[model samples]
Target chain A: MGESLRIYAKLVGAQGRAQASYRTSFWLDLIGSSIIVGADLIAVLVIFSRVPALGGFSISQTLVFFGIALTAFSIADLVVGNIERMRNYVRMGTLDAMLIRPLGVLPQLLANDVGFRRAGRVVYAGAVYVVALSYADIDWTPGRVVLVVSAPLFGAVFFAAFFVATATVAIWWVESGELANALTYGGRDLTSYPISIYGGWFRRMFAFGLGFAFVAYYPGLALLGDPDPLGGPAWLGWASPLVGIAASGVAALIWRTGVRHYRSTGS
Target chain B: MGLVTATTDRVTIRNFAEFASLIGAIAASGFRRFWTYRQATVAALATNTMFGFLRTYVMLAMAALTPVVAGYTGPQLAAYVWTGQGLLGVVMLWGYADLADRIRSGDVVTDLLRPIHPVLNYLAVDLGRAAHGMIFRFLPPVAVGVIVFDMYLPQDLSTYPLFAISVLLAVIVCFACRYLVNASAFWLLDHRGVVMVWLFVSGLFGGLYFPIRFLPQWAALLIWLGTPGPSMLQAPMDIFVERDPFRVQLAIVGVQVFWAVLMLWACHVVQRRAERKMVIQGG
Candidate 1:
């Protein structure tokens, strides 16, 4: 495991160096990515400007929700986001090249382009999360403290799992990139607000069935010590890490099944 | 000098009909090119429809708290979200960098050598793409919205023609904005930075995320008058939803026309300047 970690670090470091080699472009991209985070924040602010509350959550509480969702999504984007490029790898016969290498396909693909620029999103979202936490009026408790720290981590893991599992569909369906985006990016947008804003089966399917609620909503509710407006179980907030694990398990299985079935394009 | 003037004038008059045909052909080819990607259209339709649902729900929830927010009722907001989703592709707020790619690869030289102006060529093609998007990408989400939500439809008979005009001008204004961003490749070599900034500006100010009218009146007025952002998405949507009175709707379309002309003029100026200072990178 140590040896594998070292190898993966080396590969990622190489990608980081390559990207940083273009200093101006790298800085521009970093700033540009942070600006995207700003846009999302501004959208939340604009909505709140019109209405005092969104689905029972105040602006500050929604900020906490947005920050968590953004941080997790951005971190996932920085790490395994390029997994969505599976279609291109398949199209260009790069997967066949990876198959010949000793390294695992998933690790190689993850480290292929580290997207250090996306780190700007992490930094920006982290600042938002911290600022929102200060204003969120949470009661101090050890469990809550642990939840604050673990929420983003587990949320990142959950989002990364979504990325991988959705990207795996490219193995069977090459033109599935947009469909995957509908889930991953779409899922991020869905969780950025209070889940109570959505009603009926749409809310249930995404929040509970797909486990996006654990990413931000329940966690935010737990931090605020507010009962779920939708009347979900109280323990649901702490269930993020568990959901993260289950999602990872499902994603890994899907990825393995895809790789096994992958028939590379014949050059 | 008199003979030269006469010859130039005659040539201009002669080429007018030919240029119109050329633009039509280019636009048709653009339409056909996008139409070939049937699967892509379907996938994009699915994605747009999904976001439409998410956005519509949020708008409805906000409206539930107040009967109206920022002059928009729940039904009006729903119309805004659904039509915005449909117009998302029609106006194409982002993800068009083909011109930049060609510029980087030095293939833009061919564009310059062509008798037609590059701005006009690309504008024609974009219009064609918008035409295709109108039929495919614009309809599905909107159809779904009408079925699923209480969408506001304009009651006035003349609103249809006015909205269509607004949308056409929107496509032109958006095309010009994107053209200017892509044209920056002439100077920047890699215009990804410009593209990124464009995405941020257009997504936020172009009213893709939410209605600009939701802002304080002064801020919305500033965005509407100072930038082409509202002309791209918000104007047509407001017109469609009849968010304002009939005269105000007419004024909105008027603003779109103003921006469309101004932006196209800016594109022409930028293209001229870029051509004068053209330096092929990797020669």
Candidate 2:
């Protein structure tokens, strides 16, 4: 395990150096990536303008939802953004390059690019979260404070798992990148708003079928002290960290299955 | 003297024929190139269609909250969401770096050294791409939309021609701005950063998320400063919805025309400077 970590570190360092090689481009991408905030802003503003609240949460509360979602996704993007490139590697038969390496394919794949460029999104999300924290109007409690502080870590791991699982599926069918996007990007969009705003089928599919709601929604409910409009217990929000662990486990299992299948098929 | 004039006239006619054929070949090739990526086109269409569903619902919900939110009713909002996706492909803004790659590889020198204009070449290709996208990528989302919600066709007979003109002008404006972005490759080591900045701001100011009307009033006003942000994707979609009066539609189209001309002029100026300062350092 230590050896695998060391190898991962080395690969990450190489990618970091390669990215840092272009100083201006790196900075530009970091700042430019934050522009997605505009889209989010538009959604929030347009929805709230007609009404003061959505799904019993105020505009500031929805902003917190977006902030938490953005923070976690940005952290995931920084570490495992290269998972999105798995389609190319699989289609081009370049997965063999990593397979031939002495390192475990998972570690190498996880460390593939370690997108430093996403630093912009991280900083941007952090700033937005700070704004949300001030505006949410929630009472301060020790346990809640802990969850708020550590929310990003849980979010990062949960989303990293999502990205890995998405990439794993690419090994079988490379053309399903858009479908994968419908999950990751769609999930991000889903979680960034009030859960009750979605249709019944969508809410059920995300909560029970894909299990994306555990990654953010229930935990956000706990943080906000709001009851789950979908009839889940509000106390289930404390499971944020647990959800991260479960996501990691599921991702690991999916990845192992995909790798085994690839070895057997040699495709 | 008569013989000289006759020969000159013959040569001029032949040159015109050659130029027209060149543009035709480039445009045709551009159209055919997209066919090779049928999977990508299908995937993009699927994604757009899904987003249309999600966005329409959101807009409808917003309308429920307030009877007339952002000058759109429920059915109009559905039509807006679906048609907006199609318009996105037709205008088709992206951050590509063909010129940067050429410049980096020292191939741009030869490209510039060609007798024909480079910006015009790219514009021709883009026109062909827009045509292809309109056929395959644009209409499918709207087709999917019809089943989900009733569409709003404008009561005015002239809105169709006006909308078509608005769309054509917007595509020109989009391509022109992109040309200027690509032109930056001549001076900067990494113009990709600039392209990202362009995309970032454009995604917001271009009114992709919602109409520019929804922006904080200050941002809405500031959207028109130096760049032609709204003219790209927003103007055409807004025109199709017929949210504005005839005079307002005319004004919006006028703005699009102005931006298209301004961006094209900037491309010409930048190319001239880039050629003057041409330096081929390494491959």
Candidate 3:
């Protein structure tokens, strides 16, 4: 484990240096990414102006949901940047280098790429989160604050799981990973808004057995003291992070299966 | 005149069984190439579901304040969101990056020299990918929308044909827009920055994230008249959902035809100019 951790650190360090080489491109991407977050935020603000409340939740309350979701997504992006770029590694046959290493394949894969550019997103998510909290009724209770602050930890797990699951498919079809990108990147963009605005089965699937509802909706309900829009018991909201953890765990299992399939198929 | 020639050739080919068979065979191979990426299909479906969920919630929340916000009810809004998300998978094209890569790698020369038409081949691959997305990426979300929201379907069954035509035109318009943007890479080293700006603009104007109806009157009108984004997703969604068969169909196909002619013409001029520039620059 220690050897793997060391290798992981070194891999990420190298990626950071390499990315830093393109300083102008890096900053341009940063500005562009921040603008994306800003644009979404603007959209939400526009919607709120026209309507008094969203499903009994005020704009301030909705902002909390966005804040937590955005922070979680940003952190997830930071950690899973390497795993998500697995398509490139697979296509380039760079997976062979990791396979030959003494460390486990997952760690090397997880540590291979570091996106310094995503730091801009992280900062933006944080800044927006802080601004949202300042205006929100967020109770000053220690436990409440802790729950709110820790939302992203689990959110990251879930999102990274989604990434891993998508990346694992690279074993079968390296070029088609853009479909996964359309999902992950697009999904992140969608989550900033209130989940209730989505179509029906999509909401039910994510909220229930699929476990994505835990990412923001359920947690936000608990944090904000809002009732379940789906008419379920209130306790489910507090337990949404578990959904993220479970999702990541499931993704890890799927990744292992995908690897086995890849080895056997020689794809 | 060019379209007439193209249509006549297509009619002639369709009239011949052997030619149709060959086209079918080539299309099948193309389908197989894309279907092999089954994992991507599943992942994209999952992600689309998640996006659909969020949008549904936002719209539902809005409806809670008022039963009908804009022209759509809560359920209709749900349908709109799911349909829009699903459409992104089917209609959105990565043409710019693909074109940029070809140009930067100097593979455009080979593409230009191919015995078959480069544009036709690209269109074939795009259609195959769109079919795959429509099945794997689109149908799932739409199906889920039906079950969850009890969403309404097209009331007039006859309108379905027009919906199909509108969808096809929407896809064509989307492709033309992407192709035109990508052709810029022939001169520029990197079109990604410009493409991102274009995509962001489309999200606002094209009604990808939210319908243009929600935009202020003047802004929405400007988007409709100035950019091709609304014709791609918004107009089709409106036609299919609102059952305004005549107007939506006309808007979609009309704009698509306009853009297709414009883009093909632009491509011709740009290709000529690019060739001259390349010759002078020794590229």
User: What interface RMSD does each of the candidate structures achieve?
Assistant: 1.0, 2.2, 3.4
| Reference-based lDDT, each prediction | 0.88, 0.76, 0.71
Error of 2 at A203 (Å): 2.7
- Candidate 2 per-residue lDDT over residues A1-267, each given as its tens digit: 887788778878998999889887777777777775556766677768767767666788788778888888888888887788888778877788888888778777768868888888888888888888788887878988988877777878888888888888777876764656666676677677766676767667765566667666776778888787678876677776887898889999999999887742345
Extract clashing residue pairs from model 2: none
Q: By DockQ, is 2 or 3 better? A: 2
Fnat, one value per model? 0.74, 0.51, 0.38
Rank by TM-score, highest first. 1, 2, 3
TM-score computed on alpha carbons, candidate 2:
0.89
Candidates' TM-scores?
A: 0.96, 0.89, 0.80
Worst 10 residues of 3 chain B by lDDT: B1-10
RMSD of 2: 4.9
Candidate 1 docks at the CAPRI level of: medium
* Model 2 accuracy (lDDT, Cα): 0.76
DockQ leader: 1
Tell me the TM-score of model 1: 0.96
Ordered from best to worst lDDT, the candidate numbers read: 1, 2, 3
State the weakest 10-residue window (summed lDDT) of model 3 chain A.
A258-267
- Looking at model 2, residue B34 earns an lDDT score of 77
Write candidate 3's Cα lDDT for A1-267 as tens digits: 777677688888998888788777777777776676676887787787669776666889888888878888888887775677777777787787777878778877766666677788888998988888888876676767777777767877778888788778777877565667655666565556556555566556544656666777777777777787667677776685677777878898999888767642233
